[model samples]
Target: MTSQKLSIINISYKNDESVRVLTAVLSKWFSNPKTLHFTSPNLKYPFNINHWISTFYNEDNIETYILKDENWIIGHISVKIDENKNLAHLFHLFIDNENRQKGYAKKLIRYVEKHIIAGKDNIKAINLNCVKKNIPAITLYQSIGFQILKEKKWLKMIKYIDKK
Candidate 1:
C-alpha cells in the first residue's frame, strides 16, 4: 500500500480541463458505496456532480484539491479560507477505497496545511468537522496534530499553525 509518487493538484475555477478530469474521477467514485457513505450519507448514491462542481465555483474562498497517484485521481480535499477569521477550514476529504490506510490522507492534509501556512501569514489555524461515528477519521486527525475543539453531531477539530 506504499505509494512513492503522489501529487496533490489544486482544481482551478477557470480550468475546464481540470474540472473535466475531476468530474470523470468523481463520477465513478460517487457510485461506490464506500465513497458515498463517507462523503454524503444523506444524499443518494448517484450524487449530482454538476451541482457539486457549481458549488465549488460559487465560493470565492474555497479551493478544491485532487490527490493523484501516478495519474489516477484517488482522493479529494477542499479548504475554505476566511481572512477575517484567520482560519482555513478543510473539508470534503475522501480517499478511494483502494488507497485507504496507506498514509495518503495524512500526507494530503499536511501538504495543504503547509501550503496554507506558506501562502498566508494571517491564517493561524486549520479546521475541519467530522461525523461522530467516524473513529478512523478522528484518530487520523488526532495523529496529525488536530485537536478536538467541540463535539456534537459533527466533531469540530482545529490545528493551530505557527508560520516561520
Candidate 2:
C-alpha cells in the first residue's frame, strides 16, 4: 500500500480566523481530560477555549504548525524560542487519535528540526518535556537524537541543533 505525504501549514496568530480554526482543533483534542492534563499540565480541566487561545495565541515567541494529509489534519506542534537563552522549546505536540502510529509525529518533528532550527544560528538546542509514562513519545524523541536530561518527574529531552 502506498502512503500519503503530509504538509506542514504554518499558522499566523495575527489572523483571528486562522486562530479560531487552530483553537477549535486544540479544543477538540483537549476535550479529553486525560489528554488535557497530559499535554498541558498547568491548565485546568473542562478545556476552556478562551484560556487555550490566551495561552498559545498570545505568546509572541511561539509558532504553531499543523500537519495535514490533503484531506485531514494529522497532528499539531509548536516551537517556542528563547532568544536570550538561545534555546528552542517544543510544545503541544499531539497527533490525532485516529492518525496515531502512522509516522506523522516523526515527520512533524523532523520538519521543525530541519526547517525551523537547523539554519538558525542563535538556536543552540531544542528541548521538550515528555511525561515519563508516555513511552511512545519518549521513544520518538530518543530515536530522533533527543537525549534524556536529568529530570525525574518528566523526562526532559534535548537535541542540539548544529548550525550549518
State the lDDT at 40 in candidate 1: 57
Candidate 2 per-residue lDDT, tens place, 1-164, comes to 12576679998767888777867777788888989877877789998867876876677888878898775676989998887999999988999888889888998889888888776779899999888888888888899899998687788889987665
**Alpha carbon deviation, residue 83, candidate 1 (Å):** 0.8
State which candidate has the highest TM-score.
2
Compose the digit string of candidate 1's lDDT tens values, residues 1-164: 35657888888755888877777777787877656666655456676767776745577888888888877888888889998999998988988878889887898898888776559889999998888788999999999889999987678999998776
Candidate 1 ranges beyond 4 A from true positions: 1-3, 41-44
The lDDT values for all models are 0.81, 0.83
Residue pairs whose backbone atoms clash in candidate 1: none
Residue 30 of candidate 2: its Cα lDDT?
A: 81
Worst 10 residues of 1 by lDDT: 34-43
Quote model 1's TM-score: 0.86
lDDT of candidate 2 vs native? Answer: 0.83
TM-score of each: 0.86, 0.89
